[model samples]
Target: MKHDEFIRRVSERAHVSAEQADTLGRAVLQTLAERITGGEADDLAAQLPPELQEPLRRPRKAPADPFGLDEFLRRVGERAGVDGELALRGTRAVLHTLRDTLPHKEFEDMVSQLPTEYRELLRVDHDEFVQKVARRAHVSVDQAQTLTRAVLQALAERISGGAAQDLAAQLPPELREPLQRPRDAHAEPIGLEEMLSRVGEGAGVDEDLARRAFRAVLLTVRDAVPRKEFEHVLGQLPKEVAKLL
Candidate 1:
């Protein structure tokens, strides 16, 4: 969104007057734009008053997550071969579906509507593909699918090129309320390494060559004790391997 739209949105929801919101929005935009367009984040920090600048000087703290919304949408958009606008619409739908806890049909239709270029991205027929995005976003497969479909329907009205506003407007009435008066909460993202650690393999595929050493250590687990029993054994190796097969 442009500076004015951003200010308008924030001011509508906050105690800040329009002028104050505009100032705040400009500060935030300037901060973000500089970061995006090859300026040092430290330079922005330097521009800030001392209190804010102090925090910026320390070693850059790694974000708890690197696969953030901006990056995820960018990659997924590229793979899907849809413009960022449509991909964003799909993503918003995905996120909404997971949040409200919807059903599978919703997600399947949403995924199917995207351009065929996304085939490599999903690596599954439409049904499985929809389910996967839902699962990653932390909701039932059915719930994810349904919301995704709903998102597409909603986006039909507002989306153009991957920006969130038009899609944001189309959000379900229930969701609109929250968007209008956003809750005071942090939107923490899931990390890439954390997910690989959970899957236990495919270290090379999801990421680049530089992470091999980290993945190797992450893959190690000694002894085939019942994973359920690991903590009880104080991590001791069990004498028996329980094999149902």
Candidate 2:
């Protein structure tokens, strides 16, 4: 989005004047710069309009300040000279806009730096998740749905029951069903190639399509689950399989 349009959206969403919206947008970006790694902030700034990028430009080696939501809002409110409620509204407006505008991986990288509270602020619903995968994989929604279930079912078989359950907990209830299926106690670890084959056979797609869908599903799953939970899932897989994620 253009700088002016971005400001307009924030103003509209927060019910503030354009001047106030500009202040709030800068405040939120500055606070976010503090919260995330300097490198990520730089990358984020690159995608934003030049006028809006100033707040996100920081020292290359600056360490992130460890802060939660309360502290985050406190800093935003103080920096923007707004009340707590307006600060909260403005922060949501800015971040929600960022989510819509940034690439999935770039936004996911920023979200990964925050805690569970921040993740909840940008939670993806089932439809959104499917839509994201479909867009990423260049497939239809129905194809994405079938491919998602196939990938999850194959993943469930490969990982330990506990790990699968943990991952399933983070997914929507509809997506959770595939991960809920019974697993063989002695099932062998599946390699990356085998996984692609299984997903291709199960989803009735070609190998290339399966590979693309598998990556799309895993990347989206990484965004949906907590960083630690996603890491736990990775830990269960062979290095080859884990690298695919």
Candidate 3:
């Protein structure tokens, strides 16, 4: 898709304003340039609109830093002056659209340079999904299982109504019950600290442990869901909560 059409589709799917979508697209593309190698970044940029290619063309003072999807989103959120949630949504929109616009071989080449988890985000299956989380978090399978449930339950609570349903449909039948559980409509939106505290409480762990578990869960889900749908879920959250995702 062209830049304008790409932004329009992202705006429509993410339920953000046109200006917000533009801001998001630019932020994600710029941040992505910092994550991949200079050569791969250039190759990817060549496929983008002229206006969108500037970030990739800018001289890098140092090598691209090693980071995962969470840190990548954090950087994008900072650059975009939006919450982490919006950044996540914007990133998904741009990346997934690029996958559609680029040739199969070209897209595969770009993906090859990214970390394994990055590829997992693009096409996550159930078994691999759990294994990736366990490996990334450095936890046992049982612990990963518990963390995944907590994160998904918290996610279902925070995202929009339609997004919640869509996410439920993506999950296994055994895992669908948590998303279907009734939520308190009058509950207020909480910040990252409060949200993590709740996750810690629910999982009976300390704050530090809760944060680690949340990260594992968030990263896994971010990759498992379709990009646009993930974006919608992020857009519905408070900026603080979104940053964690």
lDDT of each: 0.34, 0.86, 0.71
On lDDT, the leading prediction is 2
Runs of candidate 2 exceeding 4 Å displacement: 1-27, 34-49, 57-115, 181-187, 242-245
lDDT accuracy of residue 145 in candidate 3: 71
List of clashing residue pairs for candidate 2: none
Per-residue error at 99 for model 1, in Å?
Answer: 18
- At residue 182, give the lDDT of candidate 2: 49
TM-score of 3: 0.48
TM-score for candidate 2, residues paired by index: 0.69
Ranking by lDDT: 2, 3, 1
| lDDT of each residue in 53-157, candidate 1, tens digit only | 432342343222223445655654554455566555444432232212323333333333334442233222344434444544455665544444433322222
Candidate 2 local lDDT, 118-177, one digit each (tens): 766565579878987999899999889999999999888888776787788889888998
Instruction: Output the lDDT of residue 140, model 2.
Output: 96
lDDT of 3 by residue, 185-223 (tens): 322466667767777777777888778887887666665
